[model samples]
Each structure stands twice: as structure tokens, then as C-alpha cells.
Target: MEKRVAIIGAGTSGLLACKYTLEKGFNPIVFEAEEGVGGLWRHTIEFTKLQTTISTYQFSDFSWHSFAKEESPNSQQMLHYLNSYAQHFSLFPYIKFNSKVMEVEYVGESSEEMEIWELWGGNGRPFFSKGTWHIAVQDTKNFSRESLIKLVQQQTWRPNLNRRMMALRCKSTRRHLETGVHQREVYEAEFVILCIGKYSGVPNIPLFPPGQGPEVFKGKVLHSMNYSALDNKIAAELIKDKRVTVIGSQKSAIDIATECAHANGVKYPCTMIQRSAHWFFPELNILGIDIEYFYANRFAELLVHKPGESFLLSLVATLLSPLRWGLAKVAESYLRWRLPMKKYGLVPSYSILQGISSCRIGVLAENFYDKLKEGSILIKKSQSFGFCKEGLLINGEAKPLETDIVILATGYKGDEKLQSIFKSHVFQKYIIGSKSSSVPLYRQIIHPRIPQLAIIGYAESLSNLYSSEMRCQWLAHFLDGNIELPTITEMEKDVKVWDDNMKLHAGEYYWKSCIANCGIWYNDQLCKDIGCNHRRKKGLFAELFEPYGPKDYVGLSHKR
Candidate 1:
């Protein structure tokens, strides 16, 4: 029998996983919760565009130049491109739309029954055949009807009662039904891959003291997820004749504020309350040069400290620290010259390199400063805020700002979302460690403690699509027996080394799984593990100086 691989998602990562698994002669079943593909791209606002250039974000085997000429494609164009790719590869037949995975349980010998060993998974058994996974899936199309049936069957239903009467009492019966009860089918797979994107799914709202939450506000309170779900027409009408305040200072906050400005247009300005400042570029160019020319190369990576570097290389990085500082100062000066960051008090205290390393940098929407100058958008800096009777209560203010709507542009809790999918409490504990600790994964793909499971798209880079593609390819190679993982002790030690390097560069945001500056280094490690040449370029000089993008890693799987 062929090996069966269950992939949970139909997003960029999941599509890549399915394609590569097929190339390796494995049967892949893709489960998607939505009716369609294109995970986060399907839900973003109309004006949202790709964060990175098209060339850098495309799949290694496919070129975006074949589709369009735009440097950065909008959300709809991206979704269309993804659909085209899926169709081109004939992946639709393997995908199950509107299918949600509820729980995953392992069916094998428990850890308590096995002898202790230093290696991960187990001691004497092949890793792939050590256990099988049972995944519970719900068909979302009939979810409502199935839920009603389940409720009636669980509580206050008699054998002699008419089906219509039983259905009528479902509302009250739902309240008494046990938590997490749903009509689901079990699927058995030898391997499972989770490709859920990190930036969506669960919203991370701030905790508030008693009486200071959204309940105290008379106006409408909406998370960014809710706002993104609305149609473009409805979203425009939401803040048309009302005072709107957006709380956050990231990409989502900027996009939502821009939309609000377009809707209200200076009659009622959109107020943006910022708790912290981050570096944002007006464009990807710095003084008529692409930003990649400076950072996305082998030589640039040598200036920063990397995980598990030799002593000689560490010394070289320390000596090159001043050059790195010079590069950051140059970029900072350019930003100040192009934008009114200093005048609006929006300049970040940290260096630009630090922002990029932590993945806190974003691109500004066109004419964003013009909106600010025309009073269509207002900026306020505050460390804390809470809900009041009328609107928001900003820190150090006696009175609240009267507004009709409050949009929380806070980000998602990706770690918690990943932890909630496992049915085993032991596996959940293994997915996430202490609150301050980063997720422990060898190569940012496989957890040493979790067997027969691999996770993609959790770790981020400058271009998530490219990053996830590389991870999926590496995972395919591993499952095909072309690569081998180190022992658990060694893997844990390597994870700690990477964590320390992240803390050194990212400072407070070390917990985030970002490899923005060290992307080439990470890809090089993947290539070495797959038994391919790490050097993708022809000559030593070009290899060191030329910018590496998705094109450089083409045919990596075939090479092995």
C-alpha cells in the first residue's frame, strides 16, 4: 500500500506540501476549512498587496513573470494566482474543501510503555511506522444540521418524539450538550503535516481589568479579523459617517486606517492609537536602489551572527559589527528624508536591522503621508488604553475620545492556535514550552518530542511563500528517506543556539519564529540536509555578492 499523508490546510504551505509529497510518490489528502483555497489572501482588505516583491515571493518552480508584470500583486490577483497554480498541478482532486480537522490522536504504544532513550520518537522502531494518527474531520457544509442532530441526540430527546419536535428543541438542547461534541469522521494516516498560516485564525486581544473591557463601551467594537471578513462595500459603509479609532501600529492597522481615510475623507478623521513604534519604509527602494541589493546576499549574512557558527566566523562577525551599524544608519537616514516620521514622533528607537530581524517592519500605503497632512488621519501615541462609555480612554487623558467604532488591529496568537489542535495533552505541552520560550523545532519543521508529524508555515521570513516552499520541499525529502535527523539531544541544543541568536538580534521579540535576515543561512542548512550543494550560484564572487531569491533554489528536490 502507498503511504498516506494527511495535510491540514489548503493555503500556500499546504499546496506546496501536497505537490511535493506527490512528487515523492506518496498519497496526500488536503483538508481545508474554507470553501476555497488561498488562506489569508482570501480574507484581506481590498487594498492589501504583497509585502515582498513578486520575484522573491513566487514558488521556485513557477515564475510570477508568466502571470503578470506588476512588481507587487494585490490580494485578489494573488488568490487567482494560487488557484491557477493548484489547477496547473492538478491538485484539486486531492483537496477536500470545507473540511475541518477537529482533533488528532496517536494510535500506538504510549511513552509509558516504551523504554527511555535519548533519541526522539522511539528507540527500536522505524520512525514512520512507529505510530499512526487518527484525525477527526467535520464536513463544514452540513455543520449546522449535524450540530443540531448531535445536540438533540445528546440531551432531552425521546425515542418516540417526532423528528420535527426534536429539531425545534435544538436551540435549548445545544446549551446542555457536552463541550466539543460534533459529528465527525475518523481518518487514519501514516504521516500528518500542518500547514496553517500563523498570521490568521486566532485573534490576540489584550486582557483588560474589570469594567474596562469592550462591555463598557457604547460604540461598536470589532477585531481586525471581523473587519477583513466584511465585503468591500459593507466595509466602506461601516465607518462612512462615524468617528473611527484604530488601535495598533502594524501592517493591518495601517491598511485599515488607510481605508477609513478613504471612507470619511477629512470630515471625520480616522484616529490611530499607537502603543509602540516600528520601522516602515515608504517603498522597497532606498535612494534609487532595491533594498535586496544590500541585505539578501551571502556577504550580507556574514556581517551578522548566525546560530552554531565556528569560532573564527564569530570573530569575523564581531569585527564586521561596525559595518552593519553603518548600513542601518544609512537606511534610517533615507527613511527620515522621505517620510515625516520625526515630525509625527513615529520613529522607532531600535535600529532598522533590529526591526527587520524581528519582522516588525512594513511598507506604507501610497499617499499615506498625504492623508496625514490633510487631516484625514490622526496619530496618537499611548502606552496603554481601555474602553470607556463613549469610546477609548487613552493613557494620561482625563476624558475619552468620542467615537462610533473601535477596531483592534492586534495580531494573532499563532502558538496557542497550534497547541489547541492536538488531542493529547502531552503533545500540546511539547508544542509550546514556557511563556518566554520560542517554539522548539529542529530545522523549524519537526518537533523532537512529536513523532510522525511535521509543521510548516509557522516560522516566518521576508517572504512567507518562499520560506514555506523550502520547508515543504525539505520535509518531502525527509519523508522519502533522502535525509536523516539528528538525535533529540543534539536537536534541542541546536534549537537553543538559534534562540540565543534570535534574542541577540531581536531583543524583546525573540519569541517570534522569524528568519528575516538569516534566510539564506536557513536555506543553506536545508540544502545540506537534503544532500544537495549549498552553493546555488556559479562562482565564489557572484555567490557572495549576488542577491538570492526563489529562483536560486529551483530544482533543489530533483538534485537530491
Candidate 2:
């Protein structure tokens, strides 16, 4: 039988995986749970815009220059661009829409049979031939409501529980289902690429005590995912003439609050309850200069310590620490001068460098501060909050804030969601052993223990599309026998080095697996590993100072 490759999710990463794998002459089947492409973009708020510039977010092989005039494309434009790319590459034919991957089981070598393996990818050969993957897929459109109810009852899935627990229970129940009401198909593949990005699948809902949960709130409570699932007209209607409280302080919270402000105006002001403040800028500019010049170049990256650096390089980084601090302060000063963050008590305690390191920095919507100044939006900083009969009860406050709508914009549990997809508990443990530690992936693609599986889009960069595309290209090269990974011990050591570097820069948010500040460095490693020229520029001056973007990585896979 011909070997088949299974690519899960038809979003940016999945599409790239399919395209690149096909370029390597492999047959790929793409499984997308949604009815269409654009994973999180399909459900985002209508007003949502790209966080980065268009040039930075485009695919290396395909440019978004047609939409270049708009620095930040809205969600619809992004979706259309992705659809265009899919069409341009003929990726639609490979996609199986509404087909959700329920579980993945490794049916290759037992513990005793695998004892002799030392090098990665099973003695430097592609691990795909060594093992086969059994994937359980459910046809979401054809699934019966009765089967869903029984599945939920058997698993005891609860809305109040965190999504991670719910996913675990659901996966566990799928294995022992004796009823024939469900329609599930099993797929066998030599390789599986998980392209499920971290932002959308399972929401990271905060846990609450029995009496202080969303169940106790009298008004309608919804997650940002649910709110974003609605069309613009319906979303506006849901919040019109209502007192709205948006919980959390990220991009989604800001966008939802802006929408509410637009809907109700100052009479029924939108209140944003923030647990912690993050660095958000009104524009990606400072002193009429693009911000990337200050941080996104090779020269700027030299100041930060990277994984597996030499002694001399470590000394250089340590000596340049003051310069890095000065740069961060300059950015911070510019943000304070430009935005009303200090006026509204939204200034974060963490430095701008830390924010960039963790990928926590966000671009604010236009006139966000103007809305605040006009009293259409209110910012409340609270350490803790819980649901009440009226609305939200800010901890230490005497009364609950009366509101008709509450939207939780807490982020998704990407790691946990990824972990729950595995049918084997051992693989789940290998994916994420602890809640505090980062996922240990060599090159942020392949787990040493799970060689047949490659995960893309979990690790984030300033431009997620660029990062995912680079990973996909490198993965294609590896699958085509052009690149070889190091041994398991070496890979583990490298993972630890990267994890340590993340901890050094990201502080408490190290688990995010963000390479935002060192994207060029990360891409260089990928290039070197694939036997391609890591230096993408012509001259040294342009290479060091000029900001690297998607254009730098074009035709990287073909070079080798």
C-alpha cells in the first residue's frame, strides 16, 4: 500500500503542511473540523484585524501585496486571503471539511521492539516507515444528536469544568462506546501533522467556586468564542442597549469592548474588567519609524541570549544587557507618550521586552483611547472577580456590578487541547508533563518521543503565519530525506536550552512557546538544519540591520 500522510486542521498551518508535503510528492489528507477554512479567523469578531503588518504575515511563497495598502487586514480579508492561497495551490481538494480527529493511537513498535533505537527518527531514517498512526475521525455533520447526548452522559462532560478536562473525558469515552448511533471512521497514516493552532479550539475558562460561577449570574454569560461565532449584525444585536462587562485584558477583550462601546455608546458604557495589564500600543510605530527596526533585526537579536550560544556570544549578550534595557525603555516611553495607558491605569508592570518575548503585546484598535476619554468605555483593574446574581463581583467590593451581558475573553488552552488529542496517556504525558513546564519539542516541530507525529503552529512568533510556513517547509524537507535530526539525547538537551531561554526572557509566561523576539534566529536554525543558506540577505549591513520578514524566507525549501 502507498504511504499516506494525515494533516489535521485546514488553517494556515494545515494548508502549509498540505502544500509543502504535496511538493515533496506525498499524498496528504487534511481534516478540518469546521465547515470551511480559516480556523480561528472564521470565528473572530468582524472588527478584528491582523496584529502584525501584512508583509510580515503573508506566506513566503505567496504575497499579500494586493492588500498591501491596508497595513492590517481585517478578519474577513484575512480569511479571503487564506482562501485565495488555498485555491491558488489547489489545497481545497485535499481538505475533508467537518471531519474532526477524535483520537490518535500509535500502533507501531512495542516497548521491547523500540529498545535498540538511539538516533532520532529511528536511526536517522524517517520515522514514518517505522510506525503507523491510527486516527479516529468523526463526521461532525453526520453525527447524531442522540449519540452526542450519550457521549456527553457517558463522559460526564460538564460546562463548568475547564475545557482540558472535558476533552480528556470525551476522548476517554470515545474508546468504550458500545452504541452504533455514532458514525466514526478510522484512518491509517504513516505520518500525522497537527496544525491546530493554539488560539481557538478549547477556551481556557477560569475556575470558580460553586456559588460564584457563571451559573449564578442572572444575565446572559458567554465566552469570547461564542460571541465571535455570531455574525456582526447578530453580535451587535446581542449587546445593543445592554450594560456590557468584558472580562480579561487581551486583544479579544479590547476588540469586544470596542464593539460594545460602538453598540451602546456612553449611555450604557462598556466596562472592561482586567486581571492584569499587558503592553498594547495604538500603532506599530515610534517617532515616525516602524517598530520592527528596533527589535526585529539580527542586530537587535544579538543583545538577547539565545539557546546553545558560545562563551564569547554569552559574554557579548551580557555586556549588551544595558543596551537592551535602553531600547525597551525607549519603546515604553513612546507608548506612554502616544497612548493613555497611564491615564487609565493600564500600564503593565512588566517591561516591553518581556511582553514581546511572551508574544503578549497587542495592537489596539483605532480611537480606543478616544472611546475611553468620551466615557463610552471604562477600565477597571481587579486582582480577582467572580460571578454574582447581578453580574460580576469584583473581589473586596461590596456589591456586584449590574450588567446584562458578560463576555469572558480568557485565552485558549492550546497545550491541553493538543495533549487531549492523543489516545495514549504516555504520549499525552510526553506532550505536556506538567502545567508549568513548556512543551518540549525539538525545533518546535517534532517531539523526540513521538517521532512519527510533527506538530506545527503551537510555538508562536511575531508573525504566526510566517513561523508556521517556515516550520512546514522544514518538515517537508525532513520528510523528503533532505534533513536529519539529532539523537534523542541531543534533541532533549536542545529543548531544555530553548526552554531555559524562554524562562529567562518570558518570566512567568514562558510556557507560551513564543519565539517572537528571536524569530530570525529560530528560522536560521531551521535553515541550517535543512542544509540551506541561513543567511538570506546579500550584504552584511542589510542582513544585520534590515528587518527580516516573510520575503526573506521565500524558496527556502527549494534551495536545499
Candidate 3:
């Protein structure tokens, strides 16, 4: 039998990993906790549409227009597109839906002898030998070690001969229903890949002081994850004729606020509580061209280098700060004329380029300005939130907000989510250490201390799909023994270079693990590693002015 490879998650990255793994003659087994394949896209209700343009959100092998009727497909349409793509590639057979990975551990030494293993908690899965192995099922509380060992003994009964195995602690429904026991397996593999995207593992909720929980609040409190999963009827009933408050200043907050305002034909308007002012894009189109074309495409991308800084471009942008600020004033003026931003005190404090470079663009929803004008959505700028006797308190105000619903659209806590999978010690010492830091994977794919493991989709870009595909290409070549990795010391140095550069360009506290603001820099490095020319178009004018998007980089790995 072909050597097995365990792939966690059936998101876009995992699907691509499966395809490339087959191309490399490896047997890929995909484990997905969700019943479907679209990941977060699969969980979206009817109203959700992708923030980016279809061109920027698509895969190289698949075109959105080929299947989707709209230029920007809705979440359901995206789910359909993913299903179509899976059918086209026949990847459905390799997927094991509703299977959650509980733990993974290495087992066995060279070839001489086998040893006994014990169960422990809140620490690394104790490894008795040096062999690669992964194993078990359900959440951490539901795991059974005796059953796990029995299953392992039954599978590897033969005399050991340099065995390399990865015990995958997984939970599947079939075993629970048939045998009234959990399903667990130890996979012997030459390699293992983790493609779990940054989203969808855990919801990032704000920490309240001791004794202040949701139970203290009279209103219905929920994270945006649960809100997005709500059906139309329940969603409408939850906010009907009630004062709703949405917390956050990003895409999800804007979306939820708009949705609540529109719920039941504007019966329950929502108050937006923002911690800080953010530069929001009122429209994707600016001056008759898409905003991405001007900022995210090729010519604009060339201006920045590693660490996302530019000597010439930085000087020009800084020297011409007045021009950049003036251009922003024009857009702000136009928006103020159309919307009641000045009345609601919704003016931004940062420049347009500041938001664009940081990947903080928030597309204005349809009729959003109209909702604000009609008193359906209100803005209350605040520095923080506090609890009151009857309701919630916004900073700089004494009056308590009597709300019927509070929606927290803060975002995901990625580090906590990613670290929750592995044992606590390994995650702390190897991945994060005591002091919190960005992911330390070299090239945002492989770690120095972790052997035979690769993580994809951790390094986000302007276009996650496109960047993930490129990563999969590089990983496939590497796994097939076509591409080689540097030494451990060199790899650590490379990670330091990336981390240092990211802080320099993106600033501290930005999502440094992701390449959100440095798509070109990250993609260019990947292309070079795969022997592909990074440039999409030739000529001096094209190099300096023309916009470059996914169309220019498709199938680039095969070019050389």
C-alpha cells in the first residue's frame, strides 16, 4: 500500500493538499470536523457574500465565472462552487467528514523493540520512542486511552521493522453508533500536513473581569460565529423591536450591524460600539476603478519589499503625505455628502493608504448609508465596554445602554485555536514559548523542531486561495523530493528575518503570522523557490503601472 498522509481539516487548503498529495503518489486522508467541505464558507447563511472580488477569491485551476452567475458570489454560491470543484477533481472519496482530530503523537524507535505508553493530560503526548506516529477520538474530555492502546496493538501486531507511525486521535460517528465506543487509529506515514485555516476553530471573545459573565447581562449575548449560523427566522425574532448593540469595527461588526438594522424591515435599529476609529472603504470602487486594482494588484505591489517597506516608495508616500491625505479628503467629502457620517461622528482618523496597506479595507454593504440616514443604525464611538446594573456601559458615557441583544464580532483568536490541538508543553516551548509570539514556521510552512510536518494556510495574503495554492505547489514538490529545505539553523534564521521584517512593515500587534499586508512579498518568495518567474507582465509601463491579480499568477509553478 502507498504510504499514508494525515491531513487535518477539509477547507480550501486541505482540499488542495489532497490534490497535490495524489499528484505526488501519496494516499491522503482528510479529517474534517464539519459535515461539509467549504470550511467557514460552508457555515454562512444566505446574506453572506465574499468581501474580495471573485477574481481575487478563486483558485488557479477553477474559475468562479465558470460556475457562479455573479461577479462576487454569495456564500451559498461559493459552497456550491467548492462542491463542483471537488466533483471535478473527484476528491470526495478521500474526505472523512465529521471527524475531529483529538491528538497526534510519534511512536516506536529505530527497529529493535516496542515499549509501553501511558496517558496524561495538559502536556505533550508522551513519546516512548523516536518513530513517527499519530493516534484517538472526540474532544479532550471524551478520550479513552485503553481503547486507543487496544486498537494500536491490533493494528501493529507484526514484528517492528523501522516503523514510522503518526497516531491520530480522532472522533468519528460510525464507531460510536455501531460499537458504542470511540474510533481511534494510528497512521504510519512518511509525512503529515496540517491545512487548518486561521478561522473557524475558536471565537475570540473579550475577557471580562471576574464575576461578569453573560449571565449578568439581561440581553441575549452571542459571538458573531453563532449569529452567522442563525437561521433567518431566529435571527429576525432575536432583534425584533429591540435595541441591539454590536461590538467591533471590522467586517463582521459592520455586517452584523447592517443585518440587525435591516432585520424585520428596520424594526430594531442597532448601535455600533467601536473601540477605536478605523479607516473603512465605503465602496470597493474608487474613482471608477476597483480599490484592489489600485492597491493589491501588481504595480502597486512592486513598490514594497520584504518587511513591507520601501526606500523609494516609502519616501514618496511620506513626502506626498499631503497628497495622500488630500485624496482621502476627497473620498471622505463624497461619502459625507451622501451619508450622515458627520452627524453620527463616524469620521475616520487614519488615511486610506494606511488601511489598505494593513489589509483593513471594509466594503460598505448595500443600503448601509441609507440605513444610517433612516436612523436604523447608530454609531457610539467608545474606547472600551463595561457592564452596568441594567445593561452595558460605553466608555466616556455615564448612561447605560439598554440593549436587547449584544453581538460580539471581534474576530478569531488564532494562536489559542492553533495551540489547542497539540499538547500544552510542545505548543508552548516549540510553537509559542511563554512569551506570546507569531507563528515561527519557516517560509510559513514548516517548523525547525517539528519533523515531517507542514502547515498550510497559516500565512494569509491578499488572496488566500491563490496564496494557499502556491504553498501547496511548493509543498508537493518538496514532498516528492524535488524541492529541498535548508538546515535547521538556516531555517530558524529565515523565520527570524520574516518576523522582524513583518514587525517593521505591519507594525506591532498586527496579525504578524499572516501575510495579509505582504501578499506580493510572500508569493514572490514562494515563486522563486518553485523556479517560477515572479513577474507576470513585461515592459516598463506594465512593470510600473499595470495592476496584477490572480489571472497573472495562475499555474505559475509549472512555468519553469
Best by TM-score: 2
TM-score, candidate number 3: 0.81
Instruction: Compose the digit string of candidate 1's lDDT tens values, residues 11-65.
Output: 9999999899888877678878766778888789977888888878898877787
Worst ten-residue run, lDDT, model 1? 168-177
lDDT of 2 by residue, 1-560 (tens): 34578888999999999999988888688878767788888888876889988878899878887744688889988998999999899887778776778888888676445545677546665644566788888766655546544542211111211111222211211333322666677777777899988776577788886689999888998778778877788888889999999999999999999988987899999999998888987777778888889878999989999888889878989999999999899889988988878899999989898899999999997778888999999998887788888888887789889999999998888888899999887788889956676788999998887757899998988889989989998999988889878888888889988888888999976668989878888999999988888988889999999999888987775454
- Backbone Cα, N, C clashes tallied per candidate: 0, 0, 15
* Most accurate candidate by lDDT: 2
How far residue 471's Cα lies from its native spot in candidate 3, in Å, is: 0.9
Off by over 4 Å in 3: 108-130, 139-188, 307-342, 433-436, 538-540, 557-560
TM-score of 1: 0.92
**Candidate 2 Cα errors over 4 Å, as ranges:** 111-116, 127-130, 143-181, 557-560
Which ranking of candidates, highest TM-score first? 2, 1, 3
Residue range 1-560, candidate 3, lDDT tens digits: 23457788888899988888777777677776555677778655455677777877887777887777665677778888888888788777777665567655544332122211121111112121245545333421233546533432211111212112233222211223223565454445545688777765577888776655567887778778777766667777777777888988887788778877787445667888887655555556666677665556544554444453558866754566565456656766666675666676776665554555455656666677788888898888877676655678766787888887888888887766667666435534566633534788877888666656788888666677777787888888766655556666667778887776565455544554656555766777777777788766788777556655667766555445
- For candidate 3, the 10 contiguous residues with the lowest summed lDDT are 115-124
Candidate 2 at 93: error in angstroms?
Answer: 1.0
Q: List per-candidate RMSD values in Å.
A: 6.7, 5.6, 8.5
